[model samples]
Target: MKRPLVSAAVVATMLSSAVATQTYADDALVVSSKIDTEGSVLGQMILQRLSAAGLEVEDRLQLGGTSIVREALLNGEIDIYPEYTGNGAFFHDMTDSPVWHDAQQAYDTVKAKDAELGLEWLTPASANNTYAISVRGDVARENGLETLEDMASFINDGGDYKLAASTDFVESAFALPAFEAAYGFSLDDDDLLVLSGGNTAATMRAAAQQTSGVNSAMTYGTDGGLQALDLVVMTDTKGVQPVYQPAPVIRRAALDNHPEIAAALAPVFESLSLETLQRLNGDVAVNGLDPAKVAADYLATLED
Candidate 1:
């Protein structure tokens, strides 16, 4: 026999003394996310899509960081959340494997491994959103530097060059060193303006306005500030960084009961190209718009 449908009010009443309705620690298909802007927006998008699909949901948005949310899901406190494909390497200790650098291999490895723990990895979005290097539009246009290989040639020819980058990018295996290894170009300490502890925005802004003679900045492919700052993301043709594509992950038990969840999200994620996500992120990150509003606007576009 089917258990009677539980009303939101009744569920709220039960969990009120324990936790907020959004953070209800029950088996009602609770959806959750981390405390970052990307997490909030993507989690909200998943939550709203489930609700719109007529699936009863508990909106547990911004619950915590990746570890916290992963713990909640595994402990049966939440049913589903967004996760990156590349994270599985560390989560499962597969960093030594080459799968993380390849999209399909990473997806396959993660899905297969997580299934053993009763988690279902759903379809992922197309947007990679991984690390990239951006040069000022004029700099790229003048030198035809559209990809890492182009940058290599320009640097090899001793073209004027200076890069503003985060300290991590300077030392990380998948960053500058990898670029040099793949593209056959090298930049000594003299060529880099190491921000030490700076964020992408600072580096991007420096390059955008040509402050300090910085001609390039490190960025993510989906950074909202790219087009606005007239910067072009250099293509990672050699696949240096690990692919960080987003996917909806659900508890196998929850999926068994509400399979429609996958169908509803498939279309949404499919439509979310890298360009689309950047604009949506810009609304929240750069334009100071509310995350819910940005999600609503994008959903409206889908309906139209």
Candidate 2:
């Protein structure tokens, strides 16, 4: 069969497209995270796992806070990062919706919504790093307080209950007020010692030391200092706050280029239960271990 002549311009255009595609495929994946102990830990895990899978990864861990890292992902400056599923409420302006309070529902909602933006939400860790009220070990043991409901009854029964927390937790309607409304208990002005910043470390310390008569303090579910400081996180049985499960969110383009990324990370995240994450975070925050070392040590255990 006789072939028709092709224009030189068309041939050149085809070659250009091929080169562009190849360049994109060759580009290093940029991983980033928020500026926090958990972020650093999660980011390091992502970096190490992807590298182990034989993919070139650029480290941008501890990039910034939620806004900064999230924006970077959206802007294509970062290929992947750890994000909280519950934050989807604010991300999509559905904070009033009740879906964020459920773990699976929250993850499903965000995964579907972000799909429109060409993002992929991978499997989330079992841990829900949401706001929690932790009490001293002695107080919890003495009063048999394991959940927020128990604390509410304790407070109503004139039990000595003083909480050390950040001003934001005190004033935010979605925090202490939400707990009060859901659990049917209230904390008086005298019952709180409002700190300046929202660092749970300080709050946990105050409760551990009984500073200013604080037997309780505001904390997160995965805070490392909880166990070491002898503080017990009160379970949110009422599910007042959104479920903030950590998950790896990646740009669809990057994921398409490296489909193995999902499988490589699934087991790691699956192993991260609430207690496991607490222990990992403690290694860094309490033990002062390097985040990379902590992540490497944890990942090594999976091989065994």
Candidate 3:
């Protein structure tokens, strides 16, 4: 057979055009979340939505902590993940700034800053997974401790109790020290049972079981174990910790291809509120259901 020779430039142009019309190696969006039940559910929600919208997706939910997932997105190993607004302050070394205290300010700062890194923040879920102080039901009832201020008053009056906290809580600027300074209470090393940072389930369990004379535990606002363990989560009435509302962040490259991604997810994220999140967390963290099932159920409800 005889064939006409094609120029190298013509071949290159044809290949490029094919990729533009169809897709290339990086076409399918890789979705991921942090190693927590809430992150898993949120990640599953996004993954499901993309699937529903007829976009090809790769699932890598619950990959690791904030840093690991953020790095993966930067390196293009993954295309998108869920992230908190307050974490932007820490990731960019702007923790001292007041932007983290206000939700809109925090979102604006992260969206603007991360844009430089080829990342895009989507509409954030209304739920804030900020750390909280939860106490045993009996302790909270007897002491009338519903807020950090009440805890402070009890502390001043010589209440005997200890706190279960992670090393991060003891050291992070947005944690114990911030609470102490905000509410005028102090927790000496004598008052804390510090464990290494990871899943907070263990720390919350310690308070639930009253281990090591501990009646207080550091918890996320949506921790399902709070009610199941007969623990009462104290209100952060003083706004000590930074707001941690989560937003779906995508690699700009992915968004460029699947521009409908943000529109597909906006309503779903908007429907997530604090109480709704707690209920969802309880379904997985307490009832022991699969995150995928929980996410699927929630998505079904969205249909009706």
The C-alpha RMSD of each candidate to the native structure, in angstroms, is 7.5, 11.0, 10.6
Q: How would you encode candidate 2's per-residue C-alpha lDDT over 150-183 as one tens digit per residue?
A: 9999999999999999999999998999999999
Score every model by TM-score.
Answer: 0.89, 0.88, 0.79
Residue 238 Cα positional deviation in candidate 1, in Å, after optimal superposition: 0.9
Ranking by lDDT: 2, 3, 1
Predictions in order: lDDT? 0.82, 0.88, 0.83
User: Tens-digit lDDT track for model 3 on 206-301?
Assistant: 998888899999888777777778777788876677788888999998899889999999999999987788888889989999999999999899
Report the lDDT tens digits of candidate 1 across residue range 62-105. Answer: 87666667766776788999888888887787777999889899
On a 0 to 100 scale, what is the lDDT of residue 253 in model 1? 95
Residue 102 displacement (Å), model 1: 0.6
List pairs with backbone clashes in candidate 3. Answer: none
Candidate that would win on lDDT: 2
How big is the positional error of residue 247 in model 2, measured in Å on the Cα after superposition?
Answer: 0.4
**Which segments of candidate 3 are over 4 A away from where they belong?**
1-26, 138-144, 157-161, 171-174, 187-199
